[model samples]
Target chain A: DAGITQSPRHKVTETGTPVTLRCHQTENHRYMYWYRQDPGHGLRLIHYSYGVKDTDKGEVSDGYSVSRSKTEDFLLTLESATSSQTSVYFCAIRATNTDTQYFGPGTRLTVL
Target chain B: QKEVEQDPGPLSVPEGAIVSLNCTYSNSAFQYFMWYRQYSRKGPELLMYTYSSGNKEDGRFTAQVDKSSKYISLFIRDSQPSDSATYLCAMTDNAGGTSYGKLTFGQGTILTVHP
Candidate 1:
């Protein structure tokens, strides 16, 4: 739970359109992560922010970008949507005191 | 080769049966291991976490880590239908640099406990 919420629980967009998904957290945790889940590929990290204005690319960050302007908000944006980018996106927060990471409800996005 | 490997099993079992899920990794630097349970169409939630090599137990779940073999396992005793979900194994190193908060996960295994 970790007081995390993602906007646009479901969305559909055409190819080549820009799309942004927002993740908000109330826990004030220092670390936030974005991941996409697809069949046969459990969960792949897209991007993550360790602190405000600090971010890094992940294993599958080629087509995605992220930003953490504030401790409570992390954003993931697709410059141009693609069919391959269609997947369930999840946001997670890492606890400051422990190694545990908690996840928020996912956003299901589909591109035509 | 992928850093972490797990058999993606759509394993179906009867209620009250013992269930075992496993994952293996090639990175010797991995010192922290964890298991997450994700219900259908929902986000994953942490089910178990262990550091280095050892076993940790909570209620009906047991997480075992064998660092020597770079392997980990999650066992569910007296499984219930509600336990049906996808299980994912994730690992990270304590090296603490740019890799600090990064987690490598397996493809995950699906389990279904029938009543």
Candidate 2:
């Protein structure tokens, strides 16, 4: 509830297609993260940005990429979608003053 | 072993009952502990957070961290139907570098409070 929102609440795309999910925040927090939630795996971080133009790979960053040009927006892109990549993606923002991270509504993506 | 472990339970309870959820971790470096509540098809919301080892209370929720045992718990007193959701336990080392905002999470436990 930290003024975060993820676009394309639901999506279905064929395998090998390019897909992009957008996460926008209004809190102006300095840190933003992208995570994918899959059954049995809990939530795995994909990528995160600590500041504008600053990014880092997470535990499960093999098939994904992320970019942040502005403090309020972070984007996750799948260059070539795969069936195994289908999952619910969530965006989170951490305020500079607090260690707690707030999440955005998730995006459910399916790769056929 | 996984960094953090939790039972993924669809625990059903009656309203006004006391609920307990737990998580155990293998890492001793974790200094920050948190609990997040996630509803179906929605984002997770932060419910409780604690640093080091101690008990922190907020309204109907209480979070306990035991660094020596590498275990943590969240207790809900007088639970309500609105409290039904998946509870996730997350931790971080608070290393203050590249790992500053990174958190490792446990497989969430599902709770349902029936009216």
Flag regions of model 2 displaced more than 4 Å. Answer: B95-99
Per-residue accuracy of model 1 over B35-80 as CA lDDT, tens digit each: 9999998899999999899999999999999989999999999999
**CAPRI quality of model 1:** medium
TM-score of chain B of each: 0.95, 0.95
Give iRMSD, candidate 1.
Answer: 2.2
Per-residue lDDT value at B2 in model 2? 90
Question: What value does the lDDT take at residue A11 in candidate 1?
Answer: 99
lDDT of 1 by residue, A1-112 (tens): 8899999999999999999999999978888999999988878989989899999888899889888889999999999999999999999998775667899999999999
Query: TM-score, chain A, per candidate?
Result: 0.98, 0.97
Extract clashing residue pairs from model 1: none
Q: Which stretch of 10 consecutive residues in model 2 chain A shows the poorest summed lDDT?
A: A93-102
Q: Residue B37 in model 1: shift from native, Å? A: 0.4
Model 1, residue B75: distance off in Å is: 0.6
